[model samples]
Target: MATAATSRGFTMPFNLRLRRADVATLNDKNGVLEMRRKKRRLLTSDWGVVKCCCSDSVVPIRMATGSGNNVEKCEDWRFDMKKSQNSQVVRAPAMRFASPQPRFISKQDKFFPRCSPRNSGPQSRDSPPKRDTGIANEKDWGISLLNENVNESGTNEDGSTWYRESGEDLGENGYRCRWTRMGGQSNDGTSEWKETWWEKSDWTGYKELGVEKSGRNAEGDSWWETWREVLHQDEWSNLARIERSAQKQAKSGTENAGWYENWWEKYDAKGWTEKGAHKYGRLNEQSWWEKWGEHYDGRGSVLKWTDKWAETELGTKWGDKWEEKFFAGIGSRQGETWHVSPRGERWSRTWGEEHFGNSKVHKYGKSTTGESWDIVVDEETYYEADPHYGWADVVGDSTQLLSIQPRERPHGIYPSLDFGSTPPTDEPPDESSTSQ
Candidate 1:
């Protein structure tokens, strides 16, 4: 292994994994072209220069490293050429390699931008570019994802340092979570522990805690204490706002009636909110939701959104003050919403084009709201047990920062549970010590 430090102060390792022919190909065409072959672990600079002594035009060749670790390390490099006595000499462009260190999105980063930069730049390899932090139009808010089993660094106002750890286990049902506000000064911050309590039956009908980190509370529990605490918080809480929900769903089936249920609540000093739905009807491409929700505020305002997929009717009511019924007729399979102003005024709106999948993940949306002033009105789904339990990003109008709910692994140690028929042991048999 060869380690070299770039001018950028980053250390990159060069492994001699290529065969003699391979290294020979990598030789500086300008220098002595000597080649060697070994294990194929060698990596070429994104642009491996092949100099031609003769001339018409000298071109620099580039290659993508799809093996082992070079996946993300490969990047763009420029090659500068000069013609002397009609002979072309290649001088590769200075490369700007992003630090190998992981680029993280803090709990404070509201700008998660897409990998496609708002402005284009030079690229070396063919692999897709990494997401750019939200500096432009797109939000690459992917704080929920990390390379398997890595930890995050965080701090508190008291100048306390916290370490965030994450991972998952798959058995009867996949389980995962993240612990936030943990490992600060004196380990004083609260650790919100969430583990999906799934009733694993080889048979269908599996239920899970849908919301991230909703199960078992962790150390320093200051947030919502009960289901009502979830409903009382008006604003979205780090783990509060009672947005935390539990989900249960029937197995996937084609042409059969598959159903799912999601119940969640939120509360604060002023009032409380509750949302739940049991949507079951055809499976595969034709599934829908039987959604219902109600809210009671101390301020005397009531809200409810319901849907009876059987009759294909979507209903809405605001404290007996205003109500609406949305139905697919004249060929519109959409829903509707209405509101009653505090001043005894009524306003209504309707939408069509129904699309549902996995109890969540909306494909498109209809018009906005006027009476409620909700810029975006939407109806989506949530499930109890999902493979996406730990990695999926929130996809609504929510702007609150979501922490990685913690797991139940031994403190300060990270290890994955292999769910295969034969679980992995601490060590595999040493071939050198085995009998002949």
Candidate 2:
């Protein structure tokens, strides 16, 4: 006789690729997917399970359906079993064809995975309480995987398992600040997983800043690998940003195979200007930007000027480029553009500047292979000005991003990641510390 795999619905996603170090830690002594013949052990608090909310039928059925009697008998047997045994049993209700329940997709299904705090909604019971960690106005920082105390560890109602740990210690920088790491795994229809990091001092306040959410569907064909970050300046006002990159793999026989995009944006206070660029195609392929934009005015309006550029597979080799600056008070707009192409061994470039009805002039390279040019306007010829000829451009000047002094990495941890990297993990505490 053969056994059937348990059918767990979509609870969450699973990792598409485990780290090489994680792959080396899998136990190989027993069968990969089978339980060993051993005595039953009691469940522990550090590994408690939450019974699924939908394990029992919520809607009542009519006696004429014939399932009514079966449900009653099953309930009676379950009561008797509970008195005799301590093990748990999960059962799904039988659905009849006559009065099939209507199912609707949830809001979570509409949005692809993103890391943001949900402010308005009934929170999940498994979610930990919001704690005030005083991340703001703190200067010291440290990372300690060994010192992290298990804050929460349990199974979610959906069959996904989650664990959270928090720790802090005094280091050379100063008194250490609080930080947390939470992650979960699930084998529902798909093997799905999510990890989110929170810290008090990173952004001068408590915020869920870093996240890595990756998982593959049950079929193992469709998958998503995503990483994102958030940074804040204060409790209100505006927020500077962090980086985000997401890769979504397509299913078999799907058009547009699949798409990959990675982009980073930085915002600063001249009313908060944003600059971001994203590229298409696999990460390894030649990176060509798909689109980019810049905005300002407290993020409520676009900047006075806008620039547009399109890139393709040919290494930004050639595409359209244009810029427009608007002056609403004067009811006028200034525009500039350029076109370029690699012809033979040299490059041919054309430049144009337009000021509505006032002036519209064009300039081109002096020759087919020349790099300099001159444009004539109103019977006067002027040489093209070098944008950087006057000032010496200094490169490699590092910007100080943090307002407070830097902190030291906690010792005894695995290879430490600089400012932004995946949080490290430590060995679990002894079994004696865990309680049922």
Which model scores highest in lDDT? 2
Per-prediction tally of clashes: 40, 9
Tens digits of per-residue lDDT for model 1 on 1-436? 1111011101111111222222222221112111233333323442223222211111111222111111222222223223211322212222121112113433333233212221221111111111111011012213233334644555445443444444544443223322222122323333222221111111111111222222111222121111101111111221123234433332221223233333443333223333333323222222222334444443433343343222111121121011211211111122343343334454444433322332221222233343222222243321111111111111111222221232333445433333356532312122211110
Q: Which candidate is the best by TM-score?
A: 2
Off by over 4 Å in 2: 1-151, 155-160, 164-180, 187-190, 200-208, 221-256, 271-274, 282-319, 323-351, 356-436
Q: Give TM-scores for every candidate, taking all chains together and pairing residue i with residue i.
A: 0.21, 0.34
Which tens-of-lDDT digit does each residue in 1-436 have in candidate 2?
1111110111101121212111112111111111123322222321012122222222111110010011111111111223222222211112111112113425542232222233221112111111111111111111223234546667756676656655664443232444455555563534443343333232132122233334333334233333333333322333332222233322212222233333333333223433333323221211122333333444233332222222223232322223223232111222222233323232334343322223333332233455555453332212111111000100000011121222433454332223434432211122211110
Error of 1 at 124 (Å): 51
RMSD of each: 29.2, 27.0
Reference-based lDDT, each prediction: 0.25, 0.27
